[model samples]
Each structure stands twice: as structure tokens, then as C-alpha cells.
Target: MQDGNTNTPEVETETATDWLTQLKNVIIEYAPAVIAALVILIVGLFVINMVVKLAKRVMEKRGLDATLQKFLGNLLSWTLKILLFVIVASKLGVETTSFAAVIGAAGLAIGLALQGSLSNFAGGVLIMIFKPFKIGDLIEAQGVTGVVKEIQIFTTQLNTPGNKLAIIPNGSLSNGNIINYSAEGILRVDHVIGVSYDADIKQTKEVLMQVMQANDKVLKDPAPTVNVSELADSSVNFAVRPWSTTANYWDVYFKVLEDAKIALDAAGIEIPYPHSVEIHKGE
Candidate 1:
């Protein structure tokens, strides 16, 4: 009985040692595969990025639509990543046939949930392709007038004259009417000046033209014009039109208006104003 008990303890020790040895061997068998899978994952991602960049450069050289270039680049990146993922999974002894199906289903569900975001992305694509307006351009859209500050995948930013930042979704911006004030590089500033009917039309024209010409901001090539536009009951209205670079538009506008007033006053040109006539009755 004493010999049997000693033998049993020895047997138990052997069993425990065998179990540990099996565990170590199992780890040794799989460690290379795991390390190789990791290396491929890292290297594949780097190669995919480089390929995407090359593809974008090629598209740019071909003069393809900027939207298409970006979209294709992103699509290629994901496609390569999915392929790399499947390769790595197969290396790790995971059956990727079913894994790919699982990924597809998950993608479909995510797509359905992000439909609105997809619409905005599509809108951004259209905006980029159509070239309606660009950064630093003055634009009026969606009841707001401002300078375009930035354009992103889902939204656009604008800086208004009030010094406020306005964020507009690309979806609505792409669908709306966009007025690009800076498209022509030059803008027309319109002004209507009313004068007493007795004021000389020719003198008013010359005076207004001189005032516009005196300002440095107004464009001389187009030549500012002054014409008697309306012979109203109380006053004669003169249309003062000036052309200036888009950047200098407001400066020329205000300068012309103020100087014209002062010039008219000095030249004895009477601007019409309403007067309250009083009458006294005696009984």
C-alpha cells in the first residue's frame, strides 16, 4: 500500500507536466501564423494607402471630376482592406467565406441607417463636380449671402458680412439656386439719385460721373454712367451705375454715394425733399 501511494503521486506529477508541455507546444505551433497574420495586416494597410494615393494622382492627371476621384479613392481603399482582412482571416484558420457574408450584411444595415448622410455625400460630390462656387468666392444661396469659407464632404461653411459663420448641409446647397457674385470678377453697383425737377439733367449727369470717376476703387474700363431714369411728379431720378472689382464693390458704392451728395450740394444741384406746407384759416 505504501509503494502504491508513492507511485500514485509520481503519476499525478507526470500528468501535470504533460499538460503544461502540451500547452507550450500548442502555442509554439500557432505563434508563427499569428505573427505572420499581423505582419500582413500592417503591410497590407500601408500598401493600400499608397495605391489609393497613386490612383488619385492618376485621376487628377486625367482631369477627371474631383468628386469621382475622391469617391473612387475611398472605395478602392475599403475594397483592398476587405481583401486583406479575408486573407489574414484565412491565414488564422478562420473560414472567411461565411465571414465575408457576415460583413456584407452588416454593411447593408449600416448603409440603411446612414441614408441621410449618404445623400449629403452625394450632394457634396455634385457640388464639387459642377463647380458652382469655390472657396473665397462670394455666393448667395438658401436666403443667405456670404463668402464661401470651406467645402467638406457633407457640409459647406460661409462667412457672412455680419462676421458670423454659417454652416449649410451640402444636400440642400446642391439642390438650391446659387448666385455666384464673384464669377464674373466684376460687379455692378446700382444707385438711384433723386433731384428736384428744376435741376439741370446734363449737369447732374456730369457731376455724378465725375464723382464716380474720382473714386479709385471704381473700374475705369467699363466707365460709370449717369442717365435721367425717371421724370417723377416731385423729382427727377438719375441712375448711377458703376463697375468695380468684386472685392472693391462695396467700397466704390459707398464712396460714390457720399461724394456724389457732397458734389451735388456744392454744385447747387437741388435734391428733392418733402416739405410740410401749413395753412391758416381766419373766421
Candidate 2:
């Protein structure tokens, strides 16, 4: 029994030595491939970065939309990286055909999960193509009104009149109605000024016209108009319409109103306020 057990240990030791030799042989045979894969990975990553940078510069030089430029850059970088990884894996004896199949399956699953994100991306593409509105356009949509600050793949940034920043999803923005106040180069400002019925209608109209004309910001070709719009119990209302450049719309609007009030007052026109008469009777 002692002799048999001693021989068993010897056999076991020989088997262990043989396994180590096989492992060493395998490493020696594949060492060059492993090193090559590492080199390729490192160099490929550097090249991918360079290519992406070049693409970004070209897009910027072409004056592409900032949002589209960024999206394309990211997409290009990711595609190049994936291709490089597959090549490196193939160098190391990985079956890239099967790897590509796995990647395709994963992509499908991810796409299905991100349906909403895909919709927004599609909407952004549509917005870029059609271009109903662009940066710096004062637009009203989705129950919010603001100047377009930036457009992105998923959302749009707006600077509201109150200086608030609003982030709206591109999906809704593309689908909904957009009223671009700045689309037309000019805007018509409408105002109604009321004066006492005793005031001269002709004189009030003339005074309003003078106020509008005095503002150089107001356009002269279209010609501003002041006409009797309504007759109320206390006053006659004159509709004062003036056309001005969109940039100066608000300035012209407020200045014209202020000047009209001043002009009317100077002309001795009375702006009547509501009043009630009280009567006392014996009970």
C-alpha cells in the first residue's frame, strides 16, 4: 500500500508539470497577437479622436447648426470606436461576426426602450430641415413665449421676456403651432386712446399721427393711421396703428403711447374718467 501511494503522488506531480508546460506554450504562441491587439487599440483610439475633431471643425466652418454639429460629431466618434474595437477583438481571436450580431441585438433593444428619445431626435431633425424658427426668433408655442436661445437634439432653450430660461422638448415644439413674432421684419403696434366726447375728433386724430411720425423708429412708407374706432359713454376711442421694425417694436409702442398722451393733453383734450352722479330724495 505504501508503494502504491508513493507512485500516485509522482503521477500527480507529472500531470501538474505537463499542464504548466501547455499553458506556457499557449501564451508564447499568442503573445504577438495580444501585443498587436493592444497596440491597435491604443492607436485606433487616438485616430478616432483626431477624425472626430476634424469633422467638428469642418461642420463649424460650414456654419452648420450648432445642435446638428454636436450630434453628428458624437455619432461619428461612437461608430469609429465600435469599428476599432471590433478590429482589435478580431486580432485577439474574437469572432467579430458573432460580436456584430450581439451588438445589433443590443442596439435593437436599446432603440425600443428609447422610443420617446427617438421621437425627439426625429423632431429635431425635422426642425432643422424645415426651419420654422431659428435662434433669436421671438416665438410663441406650447403655451410659452420667448426668444429662441438654443436648439438641441432633445430640447430647445428659450429666453423669456422676464429673463427666465425655458427648456421645451423638441417633440412638442415641432408638432405644435409656432407663432414667430420676429418672422416679418416689421410689426404693427395697435393702441387705443380715449378722449372726452367734447374733444374735436379731427384734432385728436391729427395729434396722434404727429406723435407716431415724430418717432424716427416708426416707418413712414406704410403710413400710421389714427381713426375713430369706438364711441363710448364717456369718450371717443381712436385706434392708433403704427408700423415699426421688429427690433424697435416695443420701444416705438411705449414711446408713441406716452407721446400721444402728452400731445393730447397739450391740445386741451380731456381724457374722461368714469363718474357717477348721486341724488338724494325725501322719504
Candidate 3:
């Protein structure tokens, strides 16, 4: 080998040294940022938890509705965490604008896939803001009549008269008609009673009025009214309207119906029924 071959080995050694120096420089420049990102991540999570807890306490003290409290707390937590994520990403040298664009696109995709769920969420928000119906309120909505058991973020729970639990989407429930029976604290129980046309109209009215008045549950202020509404082909129809507290509505309704029949029988007022007649097959 020629003595000049020593120059080639020297050049190779220098090249290897330069590559290691650049790698070391890169590590030195980024090591602090990596460490800082970790610290922020851990501390940020702890702070987020504390904030959520404090918010819940505040909401409870304010006497906010329980369902609303939970929803607000969750929303606050998610929003804060998203902000923290952006901070952490930026600290680690990620471009904040580009990251946000990616997140936005992903969110758009998810939203498109969950249209109904989003609608229900919006509906729930509207329900909470409007205060249409509360727990234990007897209401009719979406063609189902029941007591409101719960108002959730996406749905409403109803305990039906047949003791069935009905979960209705908030979207439809909010858009549909809702009859809040207990809103005014009082309800009018309407009854259309038919008696034999033979019975005197004045006597029928008196008898029905007495049935409502005798019941302690029926309200006296609004005053019950009995009027002859119509005279059908077979009998005279009386509109028996009784006012009662919402809680006692059903009790008054059922009791009056039974008592009216008893009172009518005592007064010898006839409730007509058709009779059957038969003819011999052969003479």
C-alpha cells in the first residue's frame, strides 16, 4: 500500500465524527422541550381535574338542576382538555394551526355520522333553558302520557301509567306537543254522562252536581258545573265537569263516576240499555 492511502482513512474518520456531532446537537436542542411537555401534560391533567371538581361544587351551591350540572361539568372538562392538548402539542413543536385543522376535519366527520345524536343534544339544551317540564311532572308528549322520571342530555325518561319506562329522544320530545298536567296545580276532569231521555233534565243535573260536590278531593273554588250538552237519540247527555287538584285528579274522576251511578239508582233515574228479543225458528 502507498503511504498516501492514510489520507483516505483520515477523511472517513472525519465524516463519522461530523455525523455524531450533528446528532448530539439535535438532542441538546430538543431535550428541554421534551421534558417541559411531559411536565405540562402531568400538571395540566391534575389542574383540569381540580377545575372540574370546583365547578361541580359551584353548580351544586347555586342550586342548579342535577342534570344540567352534570352536562355543564362535562362540557367544561372537555373544552379545557382540548385547550390543554393544543398547548402540549405546540410545546412539543407541533404547528398549532395545522393540528387544529386536523382536529376540525375529524370533528366534522364525526358530526356527520351522528346527526341524530347532535340534534338530541341541542334539544336537551333547549329543554333545560326553557324549563318546560321537571321531574315528577305528569306530562303528555310524543303521544305518551307519563310522569317525568329524568331529563338526560340526549333523552327523557318517562314512567308510564302502566309502570313502564319509556325513553324518548329529546329531539322529538322537544319538537312535539307537551301537555303539562301539573303545571297549574289543578285539572278539570271532564265527563259526558248519558241518561235515559225519560229522566228529567233538571233532576239529572242536580244529581251529577251533588256527586262532584260530595267528593272532598274536588275543588270548590272554580265550582263544578253540570249542563245538558246534548240530547242524543236514546238519552240526554250532560257535561259533568269537576275541578280538582292535579294530584287528586284521578281519584276524583273515578270516585265521581261510581258515585253518580249509585246516586242515579237511588233516585230511580234510568240508564238505558238495549234488550234482546228472539223469535221461534218454526211455527
Root-mean-square deviation of every model: 4.1, 3.3, 4.0
- Candidate 3 Cα deviation (angstroms), residue 61: 3.8
TM-score of 2: 0.80
What would the per-residue lDDT of candidate 3 be over residues 1-283, giving only the tens digit for each residue? Answer: 6685666978989989999999999999999998999999999999999999999999999888889988999999999999998999999999999999999999999999999999999999989878799999999998899999999999999999899999999999889899999899899999988999889989888999998999999999899999989988888888999999988988998999999999999999998877788977985
lDDT of 1 by residue, 121-239 (tens): 98998887778998899999999899999888899899998979999989999999999999999999999999998889888899999999888899988988898899888999999
- Candidate 2's C-alpha runs over 4 A off are 1-16, 32-36, 91-98, 128-130, 196-198, 230-236, 277-282
TM-score sort, best first: 3, 2, 1
lDDT of 3: 0.93
lDDT of 2 by residue, 1-283 (tens): 3554555878899999999999999999999999999999999999999999999999999888887788888989999998999999999999999999999999999999998888888888888767888999999999999999998888889999899999988898899999999998788999988999999888888889999999999999689998999998778999999999878988999999999889989999998988889998989
Reference-based TM-score, model 3: 0.87
After aligning candidate 3 to the native by TM-score, how far in Å is the CA of 120 from where it should be?
A: 1.1
lDDT of 1: 0.91
Candidate 2 Cα RMSD after full superposition onto the native fold (Å): 3.3
Write down the TM-score of every candidate: 0.79, 0.80, 0.87
When summed lDDT is taken over every stretch of 10 residues in candidate 2, the lowest stretch is 1-10
> Which prediction has the highest TM-score against the true structure?
3
